[model samples]
Target: MRRKSKCVLGIEGTAWNLSAAIVDQSRVIASAESSYHPVEGGLHPRAAAQHHATHMEQVIHDVLAKGKKNNAKISAVAFSIGPGFGPCLRTVATAARALSLSMNVPLIGVNHCIAHIEIGRWLCNVADPVILYVSGANSQVLSYRNGKYRIFGETLDIGIGNALDKFGRYAGLQHPGGPKIEEIARKAKCYMPLPYVVKGMDFSFSGLTTAAKDALAHAPLEDVCHSFQETAFAMLVEVTERALAHTGKKDILLAGGVGANSRLMEMLNTMCQDRSAKFFAPDKAYMKDNGAMIAYTGLLMLESGAVLSVEDSAVRPNYRPDEVEVTWR
Candidate 1:
């Protein structure tokens, strides 16, 4: 029999998605998400924040309703507290504060990046992995050491997702161009060369995106897509493999939104196979920013006595994973 565990209600609105979830140690009790689809280019910070504010009530209600049906009691309220759009983070932080107060439970502030890593670790059943965390705004190679997740490498300019979206927009594709790029690249017959920038432990994609924009003038769209993905994924994989070698860690965990790309996953898995190591990835739902990750990580923090007081609960727009002490671990 499972011992009864504390439940946490987590609110995530770091960017376009607004989500709420209740979870304990074993499983997600209930979770709900609402996403904003931009009409034109990339996400507008103010507009996304407004969308989160508009839908926050319904999203929270849905998860809270499900939690009630499951007889789940929320012991704390958790919120994503950084490395995100300022307006969106503030909006969600405000909501988390309200929820914590109304429910008379403790409030927990979660690092968005660490939440991704923790949830991936939980779902995939791996510990002490070299994490390849790729998302819209953040791309980092990290591993837990001593007291924190030490960053081994990161992008010098834009994240992989942003790079893909920029190239896709230039080619007249819609927002969130990663999936479309992957789909069209499957039909590509030949590969074209794009800039491959890697500086020691850091990689740069801004130049690659620029080169792809130029390639669109002569090369077929599918070819550009293929080349872009190949070059970029190779850069990421190269750095990730090096991190594993440096850390002597046998496990690799792919987290964040860009980790959902099948090609990226395949490339990382291939590298892991070559190294005779293991690779772990959570479901696509957990790959992106969501509430379950926050709640679950918060549960861990709560047990570790890492609670947040209402007076000191303020949003951090640029929280880094390495700045957090991994008390739960």
Candidate 2:
């Protein structure tokens, strides 16, 4: 029988969601989350932070109770410390520090982007895979080399998720527009032309989204949405393909919230199949920002002797994944 490692308590509140989880090496013992939804438009930093502050207690309480019920003893207190909204990051950091002090355990400040990659690696059981991370504010093609997850390609403007949301709002769709666009695109009668800007490895989506929004004046909504998705996804796949060829890696991992898109998954899968490479993605639960990812990553970091003190546990809103040294890997 496989042995399970000690558990870690993790908290996440980077953007729209506030989540808490307890996880060990083998699986997530318990987890809970509360989401923040904007009333009229895209996510607001201050508003989202306030929502996290309001719901954090209940979320944390639920997860800890569940962890207690499972008899899981937390060895460390971990939280998403950077690459997120400043307000939200600070709120989570403060709570993490308190927990660390109360439990008399090590405090692990986890990089949010790295947490996504680690959870993807853990859930899908892939190693040394080229990664395509897509979310509301971040988009990058990365692969592990030396001691860092090197960024091979990235967006020059807004992320694909934000681009889709911008166009969605313009089309009178809801806040998180990717899923809605995907649903409507399936009913498209024909494709409409939109801007496709790929500058070597890096791609631009602001122009593409703008062009798609304008096409709504002349084309059906479904056609515009379908064309928009095709153009954007093609750009992403092109960059990912280039990364794969450059790295000479046979495995490709899709991570981040936007990886939840079925059409995007299909495009990447087709690319991997044509190239005779393997494609891996975690379950939908881990695709977005969640506490289990932070907790699992924290366990890895703690085991590797990467712990933080209260004074060093400040939040980092602009932390980059490549900035971290991959000690555990």
Candidate 3:
């Protein structure tokens, strides 16, 4: 199949934000993200979907306007279609399908988690690497094998980011508490011993978060924060190393929201260097969740011949990463 010569408009509404982008070949021409302030506790799916319904159009318009300035004609509209809030995903998907219909272009459906891994390829140029994806709703180590992306391991319960964010909230932090915990962890010199849970290639953060909360009764919050980062990162590093060893993959790429943690990145970088392996993380923009990654992956899928019809364009809140069958052109 000949590669299509075209640009893609990617829409992402997996959770917490509404993002849209126009990607031309190797670069993102323009993109816009509208972040929502989650309620006092955390993201309420219905509330997030409501927010998307209210704000996505403006974000789409803004991104489109910016893309138009660069003479970017959207040949397709790609959307993060599953493993997300149902309402939020529906909002974005509806917009994407409508736009594709109006423009008479292909409508591509992308796996949100796979988009993160592809972003690893885009930013790091690391081919066939072990991917550690830690985000609000997902935690998994992925690799491409046997013609599809496979999950070597994943969280047994809650995602690492959500565990950390919940801990932060328990400590009276604001919405999206991972960074706040990182900040507090940076100020502590003591290290509290926290549970490190890793079973084979999989991990569990809920137990550790619970233990950390209990420890706070006698341990300084800062010390607990520091310890949480240390232990949690170690769990990730250990599983990642195991995955690499199991697969004989020397390159490791980090993606998703938690991939932005400086401490985790530093530890992984050092470990990879010591092992003579490569480690890669995208800049802040790509490191955190965004639509550009989805759009870029759409282009790759387009070139590889990955397309979906309107009928099956429904959202799966608990979509598994490896379930997606890659049909590259």
Candidate 3's clash total is 4
Residue range 113-207, candidate 1, lDDT tens digits: 99999999999999899999999999999999998999999999999999999999999999999999999999999998788999999999999
Clashes of 1: 0
Pairing residues by index, what is the TM-score of model 3? 0.96
**Candidates in descending TM-score order:** 1, 2, 3
Task: Encode model 3's per-residue lDDT on 249-276: one tens digit a residue.
Answer: 9999999999888998999999899888
Clash pairs detected, candidate 2: none
Candidate 1: where are CA atoms >4 Å away?
Answer: none
Best-fitting candidate, measured by TM-score?
1
Residue 260, model 1: lDDT of 88
| Model 2 lowest lDDT segment of ten | 1-10
What's model 3's lDDT at 253?
Answer: 93
> Relative to the unseen true structure, what is the C-alpha lDDT of residue 210 in candidate 3, on a scale of 0 to 100?
92
Q: Is candidate 1 or candidate 3 better by lDDT?
A: 1
